[model samples]
Target chain A: MKNIFYITILIFIISSCKKDGAVTNPSSVDQTYTPTPYFIQYPFYWSYYPVPIPTNNPLTVEGIALGRKLFYDPILSQNNTMSCATCHNISFGFTDNGKQFSNGLHGEIGKRNAMPIFNLGWYEKYGEINHRFFWDGGVPDIESQVFGPITNPIEMNENLFNVVSKLKSNPEYPSLFKKAFGKDTITSQLLAFAIAQFERTIISYGSKYDKGILSNFANFTQEEKDGMSIYTDIYKGDCWHCHTISSHFFTDFGFHNNGIQQTFSDSGLARITRDPADMGKFKTPSLRNLVFTAPYMHDGRFKTLEEVVEFYNSQAYLGANKDPFITSDKHEAGLNLSDYEKKSLVTFLKTLSDSSFINNPQFSKQ
Target chain B: MIAIKKSWYILMGFCLVILLYSVSCKKDSTNATPAPNPTPSSQKYSLSINITHFFGDSLFKYNTKFINAANDTIKFNKLAYYFSNLKLTKDDGSVYAPETYFLINFDNSSTAIFQIDNIPQGTYNKFSFFVGVDSLHNHSLAQTGALDPGYGMFWSWNVGYIFNRLKGNFGAANTALTLDVGGDANLMKYDLPTSIVLTSNKVVNLKMDIKEYFQNPYAYSLKTDDSSIHDLSAPGISKLVQNSKDMFSVTSVQ
Candidate 1:
């Protein structure tokens, strides 16, 4: 009886200790801890860049933290007054605060409006005609693209060499660089890589519209759903040709001549490709965050989404080089939607405004 | 007696588990079942290519002197060129090609960071690569990555990617020269498909010398006559025609 009592006590101690003890034995409940946040997790399917990703620059928590800090640091600019966040504000769906153009160092006004960055990783291509980046589409690839604002007198106003030297001067950045990359020294290439990694994480895939399409969602209002129907109609209000809406990234990744202005001094694709026929063409930006990214068009000519719709309705005047898609009609006659249809479209566009992206502490100015 | 029997059973079970574990560990350490041994001496090797520039007999150092049109002396502050589409040919006549491969912006770091993985270890007889944009990336809005815009390699106004950007200043004349060449006027207008082929075959141990290019004076000369600047900001008809003509060359196997 005494032996039995001792055996019972031993078994009790062993089983109770297991609540906090480390054991290799398989259990009914999951013991392994895997905590990937809602924002940073990879999509179900994704593609990589053309020039394959260096194994060293694989995305990681430390790399992203360093990148976020670099992105917000004004030290990237010459005068140390402006950063990428100056133009790409977090509150305004990663765009300037509905401004026509953003102000740079020494208060220099840019010619083109700042573009809202979202789901950049999913884009097979960027810029007009699926070019790399920029309103004029001058730079190719993200690595060289960062050099633009850094070197531009009107933008960052920092010399490329000077910028490198400044980054090296920062005691914090070196450690961050070492954490992200093995080495502590920061190169423009490495800096760009880190920034790209952070930007790639800025996915707007959790919008009501996203959920609607993904889960056959009914979270949105009846008007918003009606607007989406009009927006998706291929022949009618077919905005999908350029602003594609798939279950994943919500863009067709194409350029279009959306007849907004008569004479494009900007000469977007014309500036990049040097083809006369491509005159007045601009990249078709995604309409995912249109509600927050106001002051529409490349030059920020339109103050509101209504004005943008009106311009598209009028099919604003463009000359012989104009795209055949934009008919000569004053407005896109094909739309032929009632006032209610227009209201529904606006409501649906609003559903794309995700509060989570704005309020997420992770992306905020930490 | 029953207690003794129960203790013996537990001890036996524990001993059996420990014995299985030890056997498993030993199996892992030694090649327990040596099945299908890998072929020995089937060699695989790697070769690196370093691209260098030359002006005549000597290396083409950046910020060095060169004569342009009208006998104007000029020196380059920055002299870099783009080369892409590397193809490696082995002695067996097998070719290994890197897809969508290109190299630009001559940094002190790695060059043409493409890997010719799984190449059967053999002596490569020849190395080849295109010196300019391939027909694919040259397509309208049909590119990404290093092929994206704002590299200052594109003519925004003219709607064409500048195939090359050769910038420098004439020292004697105190004039600056900016030469951006890449586009076919024939393609822009009548779609005649006027494209030039600039390819080179260099023996690869581990480096590609562009020195042969600067050695030939007539092949690439700086012009400082009227607009020595030669800035093709926009790919206008004149700019397109002039730049396309100036920025290209072909070299033979070394």
Candidate 2:
């Protein structure tokens, strides 16, 4: 009986000792931790400007993981019912799902269509002019762009200070922040850094067009080939002047007035630059992933790819600040493409879609 | 009984060992702050620039009414500006640049004085500084310290710091007056002559007359002229940038 009593005490002692070890030390919990560096794997064919990662905020495994969680978490919103993924759904090529404008927390409507997010890592210092973010190129870089949606009254509608406090109060976030940034104290700057790191990693380069280019049209359909010719032909589609294919990044990454309207209501790039010459200018969006991202244009005025193709083919307005390419003599009456040609152009755009990018498990919510 | 006591002692010893092992693990996790590199004390001396704001003959304080050369009554509620790339020219023409940026606000007295710890011992006769951030640091989004965007001096939409901001009420009607000056074109540099012998710790006192921003070359009327100037391309911006160069003067050196 005495032996039995001693054995029970020994077991209790061992178990109790394990529990003591599990108790977290408050001081040690706040200690500085070095995070592992995360290197992005660019495709061998892609030769562009180096990714504009800020020297102060390098990509790290822990930082990216924390950012992914923040991107998906609704804790950033005022009502905690919306997240960045609410508007930038990964399955929709990181765009709003077939919506003209995204819906905010209080059922408020956004002014512009949510631009799809991809290939943004390459949009930097394209030439003499630095490539900027947003439809109007208002924000200078991706890191600065994170501040816009969070504070905009029609978007997430959350104050930055409140967002920081909310994240700090969460039971799980403090530790995650400590692991990522080496400090438990969360600031808006660090939050921007973390989210920006995750965004730079959301790359897309596995489209059918990419494959066809590599094979020298070996796998391309005859219709797709004809569409490509029309897209490049200045007298036909005339789209390649701005959305150049040779650069791999379809958009010129410059602001231009595409002549969507004769009299400007939005005042696009002019609002940022305060130059009347820049009136009605908007960013030239990438032609990639047309299948997933629809309801096109800055305002999402066109619902289908057919409408977008038709608008550019003949309906582009001849406005005061319209790009000279559209106002040139050859495009005086527009491309005036036939039904078959229009269909071919749309077909060629669809070839740029990459299903593998949307289905990539790394980009999906955990 | 003796055997049972022996086993009890062994179990206690094991429990103690586990406790100590857990403590050591905790100690290993606690990161030590790295020590700063030591510099030779004899070769360098600390220098502090003390700035004081004035409205004409009186001390400048926020929300206090003051008359300008335009003869308009102005009460400033907010006044903040940036100073960067500060360099001191020794009597021999050699320059000693401390390489720092400062954002000073009239509301915050603590920020009015900035110190340079490692100024090589010499006799400095002239000093110069730019009124705005350089083009490179102005455009770079990732910044910390005084240049951090959280300070509310940065324009998030345009991605540049507001070089100087003066917001207040003017005229009898209390009309709103705001002048947020920024842009690479308007970054003005001022070279002021001063005499100082730096062998040890020294303080250089400087005075910035708020009225100087309204006159000297151009007279700005708050009632008739543009009361709000946020854009760099505004008509009266060049006048304001021109007037900023004459605002600062060395009052004393000790």
Q: Which candidate is the best by TM-score?
A: 2
- Candidate 2 has a DockQ of 0.19
Q: What would the per-residue lDDT of candidate 1 be over residues A1-366, giving only the tens digit for each residue?
A: 546755655565455444334334566456543222223564453433232232534666776777788889899888888898988898998899889888778888989988887666545343333365666555444444555666667878776556668888877788778777666467666777777767767766567876676567577787887888877876546666567665344555655677776777778777656577778877667787788888888899888877776566555675646666666342346456677877777787778877788766778779
Shift of residue B47 alpha carbon in model 2, Å: 1.7
Among all candidates shown, the one with the greatest lDDT? 2
- Give the CAPRI rating of model 1: incorrect
Candidate 1 ranges beyond 4 A from true positions: A1-39, A42-56, A125-132, A136-144, A210-222, A233-236, A246-250, A318-325, A328-340, B1-175, B180-254
Q: Candidate 2's residue-wise lDDT over A196-241, tens digit each?
A: 8888898888999989878997888888998998999988987887
Candidate 2 Cα deviation (angstroms), residue A60:
2.1
Q: Where is model 2 chain B poorest over a 10-residue stretch in terms of lDDT?
A: B24-33
Q: DockQ of each model against the real complex?
A: 0.09, 0.19
What is the Å distance of residue B113 in model 2 from its true position? 2.2
